[model samples]
Target: MPAADQNATPPGFGITLDTAAAEPRVVVTGELDLLTSPQLQEALAGLIADENSRRVVADLTGVTFFDSSALNVVLHAQRQAGERDVELAVVPSPAVSRVIELTGVAEHLSVADDPRP
Candidate 1:
């Protein structure tokens, strides 16, 4: 039995930040669960904290798995964005859409079918 590599990144999981756009975009891919939700939280929080940021787009179209943890992050980010006077929109993939729809959180957050506004 060999010890697992704790420092290794999970396969197919990635988070990319694009601030060059008119609105900052956080692009997420792969599974989003308890282990990876923190990363998302951090990313969104940073974007929301920017005083000049008017909107933030979270592109989850590449996500293959969505979980409650990820949903929590999204909801929290939405609230934060609102408080900061910043809009938060989510572009969901099929996997994420199912969870968002089932949880009935879709009404609470802004959802976009297309990545662009």
Candidate 2:
């Protein structure tokens, strides 16, 4: 693994996939809505597909805004991680956590203080 780098910015969103650590970290910034959910989905899917992947941490601390579509993407990633036997944790910003708590998905996914390894 190398150092962390800016991976992509898809329209209204930006994703930084840090693969240098033991468990890859995907940090999402900007608005996570209908237009940006797929970017996150693809990034997470790519991380999960790696056989070397043991776990993946989604750091949503940079997210300024979040919506149900983004939450849906996280939930889907959680399920995929489970099937792959890969641990998945989420570090949510206040805005993101509020939505997660409201939707009761927080209990289903591991919420961590640190998203880094």
Candidate 3:
């Protein structure tokens, strides 16, 4: 079996996890659609499972594309976060913002400003 890189990046996509801060942040890049949504969901799920992860910020500023599937994954993560007593926030790209606006999912998520430093 191949060993997994702690910084494993999916094909055509990348995820950066920063857990040192008060709130863990997951920065995603590349296209987010049906094919890549599962990878994102899995990453979010791991964050939710962590006991120290009381709050999570998903920074999608680097996302070039997004779709309904991507929206659903974020929504699901939000719901799971609630169940785990974790607060979830998202820094969406313009493309993601458009879908959230169209689907009325924005109200359900805490949208944060991009926190890249």
Using lDDT as the measure, the top candidate is 1
Model 1: per-residue Cα lDDT over 14-45, one tens digit each: 99999999999999999999888899999999
Better of 1 and 2 by TM-score: 1
Clashes of 1: 0
Which runs in model 2 stand beyond 4 Å of their true positions?
A: 1-12
TM-score of each: 0.93, 0.87, 0.84
Q: Candidate 2 lDDT, tens digit per residue, 1-117?
A: 976444444555678899988789899988898777888899999999899999899999989899999999999999999999998889999899899888887778989987765
* C-alpha RMSD of candidate 1: 1.5
Q: Give the Cα error of residue 23 in candidate 1, in Å.
A: 0.7
lDDT of 3 at 68: 84
Candidates 1 and 2, the one with greater lDDT? 1
How accurate locally, in lDDT, is each candidate? 0.94, 0.87, 0.85
Which scores higher on TM-score, 1 or 3? 1
Candidate 2 versus truth, CA RMSD in Å, comes to 7.6
Residue pairs that clash (backbone atoms under 3 angstroms), model 1: none
Q: Can you write out model 3's per-residue Cα lDDT over 86-113, one digit (the tens) per residue?
A: 9888998888888889888778998887
- Report the error of model 3 at residue 68, Å: 0.9
